[model samples]
Target: MSMRVPGGGFDSTNPIRLDFPQSLAVYDDYAAAQKAVDFLSDNVFPVEQLVIVGTDLKRIERITGRLTTGRVALGGVLSGAWLGLLIGLVLSLFTTAEQSSLAIIVGTLLFGAVFGMIFALVGYAMTRGQRDFSSVTSVVATKYEVLVEHKVAAQARELLAGLPGGLPDPFA
Candidate 1:
């Protein structure tokens, strides 16, 4: 999303684009790109005129472990325990002194664990052997490019040049 500034150029609500952006440099990783901006800030350059863009996106799924009935049941029990504890605390707060809050909490905790285990086992059984593993998925960029507004591109480049080993690499 972009909006027209007072000048002929435009500004973006996205906070990442510039008016006629010029590539200040390309980096192999996000940290490097961040470092470039940090360097500019240290030098008192107009840091707000810059943005870092990730390119060449790819999806990655890292397998954590194989799932089993025991692990699933244990996970469910732990989750339910937390929920039951919360409920029991609130219910105990309204009870008379004759009613032992400890007993009420323990009762609810046991019931929750039993129910959670049963539900987790039944759900796992329905899944069958189709999806038996656990994994984490994420989308990441292979490259990061730093951009600067056209009006300040030259100043940004000059400041970046002063950074140790930060000159824009033509071949990069």
Candidate 2:
């Protein structure tokens, strides 16, 4: 006769954490994570069952889309300033008897620089301090985990075991 156990034989000591359930395979590079996903897919794993969670939200966003609005605005302001300077120079060249005056050139350059700075600052501030403004570095976290759907968790584990890396279980 089989002995009766409570909660369908699930040990209280093994209470599953719904937030982060399985294992983590930390790769030094994102390419590795992508390669792992590709390999799993090639082996008949459906894409829907796998999720690539970027540890860095900004990096993921950038990869999935074109330049952010701040970058775009900054670029536009810079380009517009340069164009304006060129137009001003041309106007001065035609209007002045000899050459563009130093005053005009300096004034235009100063105005352009100030405008560019203001636009950049405003664009950056619009992000509400969610991103870094001083640098263009593709910010990413040290670790990113590939979450598997609960239904295909066992298959994922099996496929991972067949791969080169061993998945390490992480805890809070």
Candidate 3:
């Protein structure tokens, strides 16, 4: 769906611009691609005409650690305690000066710890030893390409050529 920006130039309705876009430059990393665009913007070039597209996508997953019953219970306890402390603080805001907010916070913390431990233990047991490892996954791109409307591709290339090592080597 097309999002109406302040200026009606970008047609976000389509992933790729239907009005032919030509590659202005390609960089190994996104930062370099972004830098090129920023440079163009600083030079008063039509930034709206440019788009950075990531290609050669890859999904990487890093195994953090093996999960154990004790570890799970400890993690749950810590998270629950934090949540309980937040709730207690919010609730205590409505209490009168005669009521001790400390008592409420401490009571909630204890209850949270117990509830957390029980839930953690039960969840771990239900897992049946499946998915016992923790991991983080990310989708990354190998290359980032700067695309500009075909009409302004030449101007973009010329502007980019002024930047240090901005142009990709044709020999390599």
Candidate 4:
């Protein structure tokens, strides 16, 4: 089944299906593919008929640093303090002048810091050094492909040919 948009065109129910798509161009990066589409839009091409697909995906992990109890505790303290500060501020808004807003804020902050440190230490201890390092992971694509509906492929090609260095060598 196909879903209809306001303009009466069938909105693609499935993103993966290309609907008899033809490759307009392929680039090593997503930005280049986006730029090509933007150029098409500027030239009054039907941008809705285009799709950018990322292919050859790879997961990359970068080791940031070694994990330690002290670091964990510090992180916990900072995060907890921020949360406490936000809570305290909200509470302060509802409090009267006689309620001493400053005390409440400080009290919550101190409590949060202690709580955060304890939680962090407990979590670290539970891990038992099984995971000792911290790292950031990202999934990236090696290539981006510009796809157009088959009917408009020739027009897209003709327009892209006017762009300098926009079209890659088909034979290559």
Candidate 5:
């Protein structure tokens, strides 16, 4: 049977080394990790053979929510962009320009839109697809975990063992 292990971050001293088996998937966030497990179950991945390691109650709930949402990052970048453009337009009015040209107004709008898009893209890229902002909640921290496909946990452990940081804490 495949095993699931919560991969933990090693402290500064005495770095933990794990031999993670093959067919393993690592998730930085607990919710995303669990979501994958849930999806696999609904899509013919056996639940009985599944193992969830190293997660807390809060992380489990968050991952369960991701499973329900189907991996859509909740926040609306478009809406944010629109609001930013409106604010930019309003602020443009306060600027002291000798003549208000059509080009100037259009340019301001374009600038606002472009900047908004850039900001959105940068933020999105930095997040690496974990920004579920629609619910007004923030990701507190990153959770590392190794999940193996059903019946491959042993192989996964063997593979993980060779990885730089693949050990699970005996205490945790």
Candidate 6:
């Protein structure tokens, strides 16, 4: 059985869902939730009847470094260079008798680097110092919950009972 995400423009099976899911266990970390599922799998509990859900979503951004003009320019140049290189290679693939592949590639690479650097710097400048630091951002769940199809919830819960420390459920 499958479901479609509303307005997600999807016309295929949705693997992120379970039918009549019941929370079998919840844990503070994904590992714990995964461990419970692993235990169920080990006990032959028809693992297909399970799903792991991350709850209490939180967005975190870890600052990597401070941004500078030179750094921005270099980053842009490298990015643009890569794009240019890709375009050049594609164009070179259909090179004619009068066309030189080496020239095409070199030209594209240089152009890409220059364009990338300029674009990067311009974008950074437009940000107007609002965001000056480089950082990586990610959304994480504060807790993970192991859920099972309603029909197999009991079986899964029973199997998880054998885990070394057993599963912990604050709500239970």
TM-scores vs. true structure, each candidate: 0.84, 0.43, 0.82, 0.86, 0.27, 0.86
lDDT of candidate 5 over 1-172, digit per residue (tens): 3333443322234233223423355556666556655555555533334444553324222333331122232233354556656766776677677655555566656665666556656666676656544343333444545445445566444544544444444345
- Ranking under TM-score, best-scoring first? 4, 6, 1, 3, 2, 5
lDDT of 2: 0.60
lDDT (C-alpha) at residue 5 in model 2: 36
lDDT of 5: 0.49
**Model 2 stretches with alpha carbons more than 4 Å out:** 1-24, 56-80, 83-134, 166-172
TM-score of 1: 0.84
Where does candidate 1 clash, by residue pair? Answer: none
- In order, what lDDT does every prediction score? 0.84, 0.60, 0.84, 0.84, 0.49, 0.83
Residue 4 in candidate 4 has what lDDT? 49
The CA lDDT at 27 in model 5 is 59
Q: Compute the lDDT for candidate 3.
A: 0.84
Instruction: Write down the lDDT that model 1 would get.
Output: 0.84
Q: State the lDDT of candidate 1 residue by residue for 1-172, as single tens digits.
A: 5676553344666655566889899999998899999999999877777888999999999999999989989988987787788888888898998999998888888888888888888888999878788899999999999988898889888889988886658695
Q: Write the per-residue lDDT of candidate 6 for residues 60-165, one digit (tens) a residue.
A: 9999999999999999998898899899999999999899999999999998998898799999999999998999999999988887778777777777878898
Positional deviation of residue 66's Cα in model 6 after best superposition, in angstroms: 0.8
For candidate 6, which ten residues in a row score worst on lDDT?
2-11
lDDT string for model 2 (16-100, tens) is 2222334435555577778777878888875444555556444533333344566656675786578668766766675565654
* Local lDDT at 91 for model 1: 85
Residue-level lDDT for 67 in candidate 3: 95
User: Residue 167 of model 2: what lDDT?
Assistant: 54
Stretches off by above 4 angstroms in model 1 are 1-13, 168-170
User: Candidate 4: which stretches are off by over 4 Å?
Assistant: 1-18, 170-172
